[model samples]
Target: MSQPDQAPDQAPDQAFDVIISGGGLVGLTLALALDQGGLKIAVIDRLAAEAVLEESFDGRAAAIGFAAYRMMETLGIAQHLGEVQPIEHILVSDGRIGTPGRQGGPSALTLHFDHRETGSGTEPLGWMIENRRNRLALDIQVATRPGITRFTQDEILDIQVEPGAVRAKLKSGTKITAPLLVGAEGRGSFVRKKAGIRTYGWGYDQTAIVTTVAMEQPHGGVAHEYFLPTGPFAILPLTGNRANIVWSEKTSRAKALLSLSPAALEAELARRFGDFLGKVTLDAPVWSWPLSLELAATWAKPRITLAGDAAHGIHPIAGQGLNLGLKDVAALAETLVEAKALGQDLGDLTVLERYAQWRRTDTMTLAISCDAFVRLFSNDIGPIRALRTLGLGLVDALGPARRFFASHAGGDVGDLPRLLRGESLSPALN
Candidate 1:
């Protein structure tokens, strides 16, 4: 078995085939995947593993697509996801400005994506899971992998890629070397900076205010997206009658709105969200995050590679941020495993390039699509609004077009990795 690569001044430990930085969901999940692939791995993070595992399930939730759910299952983390709320259907509509259809005379056009009708049989397309639970599940899985060593409260200070190995130095005075280094450190990844890899993307002049609310009426397992003038207000179903809300608005407006008194904030929320959920009361602390779309100039350079938020960070308008990262983990792990099976070096440029090629097109497409959606639909103007509303109506009226859109939301688009296809990783031969 491989061992951890120690610093020059420290005692030698087991060197790892892969060294992963960051212990977030994406990072830990990738560590588990690599371990399952028979590669001894070490994962380092700035936060304690217990802290991640013991986090409370609150308003912060993720809309997990079917494919993502399947991957979690294969990783042995899905069963630990607490209180899952299946998304039985999704209702997409525009606010006030109605789309053309039916006898309602240009009322909001509702496009329902029912999983049962889409050849998914009795299974729902996806489920809503609290982010805390997702992180906890990953922590648990990583802890059980014998091939993986996890270090928390340790931050990476720098990375040095040599001819045949990559070295990682930690702020805690620890060091490790591996054939491959995976940067899953998040948007402001230090590994990316240490590698001198430039990034390309811009920030949307918006902030998403997230919180949960107790609604009087049941959501009936249906997620709702209301395209408002400022941005899309997503009401994702949570356990019971509670729904997680991600309301995007102009940064200036968000700042002012966040400063409003509790009573005033409730009033504003009710007005924007309408009476669909009846009386709504905030059930969690409001958290706001600036929206941005960031992509690395390159996913890999020699023995160092980027994954998840380290590679790409996009606006959460489509709720596909985590899913995209999970996709990266699956693809990268599979690429390395396949390379090993062919007696090729896992860190070879050819092998790593395949992984980068697999993700680039899809990543770029989603980034551009999300940016365009945010730009076009977030504005309230005479001609643009009318045109977009009409476009929504036209798309809703077309069945094939609607199915195509639904498939993407369901994570059924494009080539899927073996892990996403529900293939189990083989036991470590070593």
Candidate 2:
């Protein structure tokens, strides 16, 4: 083992089947998924193991969709998750406080989604896992995952590409050469920029304030999304009487609200958080994120590709960011595993294009739909508000339509990959 912040104990001129930039949750998941194809993989991350293992990781939570949960199980890490909260029911409502005709009675124009709506009566629609717990699981999963090498606290300084191979040089004087390179980094991917992929999108005038809250009453395993005029405020149930809060507001207001004292912040929270959950108080540091929409013009290059937030970033109104990345994991894993089994070069542009083609339409459709959702719900216009409320009501009244929406949001209603369907990646294993 290498010392802290040092290169791994391997040959200086190590080679791998795939070299991945970024050791984040998405990146680690991708590495594990590709390893199932019997391909050697190397992960380069600047964060130290200690930082990744810390108990307070960004103080955030991820909503693992039903399909995403299955993918996690296939990667051999789901059972290791310390604890997770089940979201058996989801409620969507329009009109936040200060909006016209908004009385804040529970939630106005509400739409409820039941887990049975997905036709899986025994399973939850989704699970809420803490970011810290997920990262810890990834650390252990990567350590146990075969065909993969982890380079912690090491940065990829430069990359030299050729038709046959790509060589990545690290700051610690270690060099790795591979035919396939992936950028699972976040939106500002160093590999994506090096591969000459351009991104286009704009930041919303809104910002999301995230934190966990402890409630006086149980959450009943329900998630709530209250569409405020400024943005959406969500209370996602956590392991106990605690729930994760993602309150979106105008950038200016969020800034002011974040500056409030603990008492003032709790007061503001109660204003948006209804009494349904009883008293609510902040249980963690309040964090805010600027909402935005950005997508890579293309998902792949000669011998390089991107996944997760590196490829697309959408508004969090739907809480599908991580789910989208998990979908990428499933699709890319399926693509690479299928290609390797056929004796095709996994790095071949044609082979990589298959992955891109598989994801292109679905990703864009999600981005556009999320953007439209934000646009529609963020408006305070009376007629538009009434129309959206009626729309929610219609869906609520229509059982089939409600179920369709439920399954779609649960991420079990689309063209799924083998991993997401709980199938083996390697045909021999099957």
Candidate 3:
């Protein structure tokens, strides 16, 4: 890592309320959430703001849950995100050739979830947003907030936990102190490592190839998932008749497939995607990410805590990675703010413990659920495939079960954080 630029006036003795490493989505959102509390916050990142958005599309997008959408609204950043596309329905199906002996006669089972059925009214279950857009909105919000200080082109060289504060040394020879330190640095977080925290998880032997495609027909704001033997192939609705595709395949095969010509790649995609959307053409550069399931052994200790991918990384089969991180920002912010009101040290063990306890169960549950779904559906075993198809059929036949899943997808599960519950942390921006 390169050295950070030094601040001429050093105030190591003066402490900030929080020092967050890695100014990605989670870190920036957390900073905004704490901005209203009259606390001093400093966010450090290695990359400059402009460098983060140099690429268009970048083959990455996030499925922002309804609750997260509301949280963004409370943060006064949602409206700034360009071209929000709602996903009104989600369709899941198993794409496997069945024998004639099957009871359903080789018909593919479809499980559909509609947001309107759950009294969400006209509101969407979630919005599909390009990752860069979300980051840009966050950067703008952070820049406009009065109490937040942002440090770009800065890298953390070392961290030390003192009796009353956590001190961080930047490579630029500048030092900062804060009562609480948050790690939002992503999967391979340097902050988590400096704090001596350990994680337990394994990588799946799969690589996810992501890109955008222009389809003959409009997506109609529907998200489609096809469970093939290799992995799950998802087509998320985008603005203007375009769909974002995330196709997970075996590692070796993914490398070879990625090497194919654009025409060859489009041909393979159309073959697997079928003609439901008519002929599809590649519209963006392809990007690939390895699949993994990672969980930190502990979320908080002393004045240190972890959030977002820094704490837990799960399968994208459910598109809940960013949603989960947003939840973390909400929970941790709430805990600290409420603690301050009650005259408790924001970094007190009891206060941090509360935040950890609030998030542990939900994070683990989602991780296990996604992992299980990926494993159960990503195999071509005859008996297992039959069981899964039957299960989907049963879910489709049941109304209450379908609604339950829909509610979960709409981000209505668990003890929601205040922002996610549609309560404003600060006054709405005009």
Candidate 4:
């Protein structure tokens, strides 16, 4: 093994069936998925695995949709997740900050999503696991898979896309080649940029303040979204008497709020948090992320392709960020596995376009919807507010409409890949 932060000088040039840049959650997931289907994968990441696996490295968590969760389970990665929380119900409401109820709670006008109504019977909407826990799980799974090799604390210095393969030179002086290269490195993807793909996006002028809180009372597996004038404040249930808070606010207000002392910050949080979950105390250091909506002009180019945030970065209003990326992994893996089985060139644009087409509409629709939600709900215009509130209530009352929304949130909409459908990615299953 190479020393920490240093690549082995004796490491010879390597080749893989697929080379994935940025071994983040999305990249690692793709590596494992393709590896399961008998593809040799090389995952190169700039950050060391040991550094990123630390608990303090990332305090954030993700809401893994049922379908994405199934993909992980299908890839044999779910068992390593230490512990997780299920979201049995979701409550959406529009209200001002000082509204009355359980001491400044949501208005009576609310949209409620019950897991039972989602047509899946007892299945929860999604599972919530801390980001570090997920990384740990991926690391554990990666270690056991001989087909997947990882190079950490290394970055692609340059990329060369040939007619038959994509070659990458690492900063550590290592050369790697693959039939296909995937950029899963979040917004500023090196692979996408090297492919000369353009992107279109805009900042929301909003920032999400995230932190975990210990609640005096159990959350009952319920998630809450309160639309205030500033932005949406979401309380996502976590295991044990705890919940994750995604409090979106104007960047200016978020900055000011974050600058406050711990007690002051908790006081502000308590006002929006209300007494629904009893007294809530911060259990972790707060983190803030600037919100934005970005989409690549295209997801594929010759020997190179993009997945996860590299392909599309959407607002987190719906908590579908990670799930969307996982969906990309499933689609791309299925496409590549089947193509390889057919003796087709994995780097061929024709084969990659299939993966792109399968994801284009789904990703675009979600991105637009999330942006719309952010705009529509982050306001107090009387008529608009009333209309949106009425809309929420209407959707909640109509069984069919409610179920459709619930099902969509559960990632059961549109055509699903084999991995998402809880099937093996083996081409034999095709």
Candidate 5:
């Protein structure tokens, strides 16, 4: 039951070291990270804090990569995340609905990514936590830090990035100024648009149907990515016998499936869900959204920068969206914290470009790979299917290749910031 530090009606003119628009996962994370580094922050969101905690607010769950999970542990938020399921194993295969495998249903060849391969042997590849649970943890953690001032149930009406400062006027008539303004809002970010930063991407022909399912048997902490003719159907384990379903299909097919009765939809899910997890039934409401691939033209514009979905939106074929954003948070927080230690201007483009350059190549590489995966697997073509199936077998058979892919999925690839490496940022200021 964390409360906003400032009530919208009682909010007065104030200034902070940073002002972040959109108090979603990425934004709140940045606020917490900066606050931990001794910087005051203002977090503004359109929805009330309680609304964000509601199950109906967001039905999706995010796969927290091991590296990102370590970051959270360092931030003091991990201990508060209740009821999360670790991803002990991952099985990726290609097949259409009801297709039979060598010993069972699904494809014969599969690429397996085991947690043991990460060199820790006992550490999980990642953790699957509901979006609401994650928000709750972030809300509680933000409340513990007096450096953060959260402005909920409000919108930013105007923004002006002048010399040395960025000023924001909220719809509630509250004004706040900061050296840097960050847009962690989703794909359609007002801050980014207001900054006149253009984006490049196209809407995918697919839509993702997200919901929770109760399996008769336990999921054994295993995650499955089944590639069908339509798209990738992900079965991510949760606490108990429940699993999160992220089913992607053609826009038209998803619309029709969503229009069906609860029982009817369950029947359709069973066709692809298989019996490996035993009988499966819908345990939660169904939610779907059209998929797309979008990347901002630039991440930094004097006094302003973008993070998370505001900067890049990729297909969920791989669950790297939030992990990618968390990386951005780590990078940006480190850059700002170190700059402040050196008495450098946080809003300077030269200072912000450091964050942008560190994330650009990594973000683009993952985005392109996800798009490629969707195109390669979401087809029933003859030669392409055979080649891809063979590719899966090849990757699985190679020891180094399998371990490499496993590490990549765990967010262990690339130049990691201190937080991502499970280290405090204080040393960076040294």
Candidate 6:
């Protein structure tokens, strides 16, 4: 088990190199990354430090893209998260839930992405690991690193960013100073909000109901994404004969579904699940998230910068939210480490803008793509449905295109950071 969160042996008045406002996955990873690169960090969050070290399961699991998985491995956290289920094959199809295929058989406009074709050298498309497992693993990892302090149950009331310093006033009446401030807080980031960074996003009329399901048959390491008029229904593989269900429906219908008796919910699951898994039963309580796409207007200003959900939040249709956050961790870590090597101030607007520039285009591209997918797939229009059915067939037939998309979905497409590439952190310093 990891030790409780505490500061280093330095003077109580000493300033830190960086202070992160949210100590969830991204914040913790950043602290680990920067401290490895020789920077002191302070992390503050509302979660109790003791509880964070336990084997807590949050009911939601994340799809770790292959690149992000490599980054985790490089950070020495991957090996500790036990029993990750790899996605060997992904099958996508368009079908109405209660509607059958043509000729009263089964719809066959299936699109597939095979992991073997990704040129990733035996790596699967990605791995599905529970959020709790990742959090637990990181909790242990952070306790062993020096100069990385975690202050749980602490809230920052306000932030003042000066030319080369950031002073954060906590509700507990503590004033912590650091050269740079980073917000890994969620979409409703208080720090980002205080910094006057506007956000633009819209809610889908849909909600996603998530839970684990046990079945009579093994999953065989395959993932399924079935597009319904309501939204995409994702069945991700887990160890043994279990899978995670991310089922989407209209907000009202979802609320009704969640409010039903256990038997009623089981019948509802059977209506969409078919006989593929065989004898499915709910293994846990159903959890839900209202679908939305939220993007920060600006990622950085002067001594402060935003990462993870603070910067952008998107639809989970592609399961890239956490992976994207990890990308931000890698990118910000690389940027700040290199900047320090050049004798640059980590909080300078010029330095911060470089990080923002490197990330803005990619984040927007993902946001737009998620919006397009939700719009195209979540509609009941007859013509659009027919076109999508045809598109699925066409995409399946195009081998090279399918392979490229698979790799892209696996987080192998654009400019990758050193961490994602499985390289050492700050090679010169090492």
- Count of clashing residue pairs in every prediction: 5, 0, 1, 0, 0, 0
Cα lDDT of candidate 2 equals 0.86
**Weakest 10 consecutive residues of candidate 2 by summed lDDT:** 98-107
Per-residue CA lDDT of candidate 2, range 308-361, in tens? 999999999999998898889889988987887788887899999999998888
- Per-residue error (Å), model 3, residue 9: 9.5
Q: Which candidate order results from sorting by lDDT in descending order? A: 5, 4, 2, 3, 6, 1
lDDT, model 4, position 207 = 96
RMSD of each: 3.9, 3.1, 4.2, 3.0, 3.7, 4.0
Give per-model TM-scores.
0.92, 0.95, 0.93, 0.96, 0.95, 0.93
- Cα lDDT, all candidates: 0.81, 0.86, 0.85, 0.89, 0.90, 0.84
Q: How do the residues 1-430 of candidate 3 rate in per-residue lDDT, one tens digit apiece?
A: 9778556445344468899998988999999888865567999998888888866535688889888888899888897897789998888888753334332111356888877544365678799998888889998888888799887999888889888789888866678888889999999999888888999999889999999899997779999888888898888998888988999999999999999999999988876776667889998899999999999999988889999999999989989999999999999988887787687877778899999999999888889999999999999988998899999989988988987777676677778889887675552321
Clashes of 2: 0
| Structure candidate 6, residue pairs in collision | none
Question: CA shift at 105, candidate 4, in angstroms?
Answer: 2.5
Candidate number achieving the greatest TM-score relative to the actual structure: 4
Supply candidate 2's per-residue lDDT for 86: 85
Candidate 1: where is the Cα deviation over 4 Å? 1-8, 53-59, 96-107, 116-121, 427-430
Q: Best by lDDT, which number? A: 5
Give per-residue lDDT, candidate 4, residue 102. 47
lDDT of 6 by residue, 1-430 (tens): 9867554333244489899999899999888888877888999988786665544336888888888888888887887898789988888888886674431112566888877656565889899988878888888889888779888898888888776799887766667898799999888899899999999989998999998889888889888888888898888888877888999899999999999998889788877778766878988878888988899988998899999999999999988899889989998999998888788999988998988888888788878988898999998899999999999899899988798778767778778888888886855646
List runs of model 2 lying over 4 Å from the truth: 1-12, 98-105
The collision pairs in model 3 are: 4-172
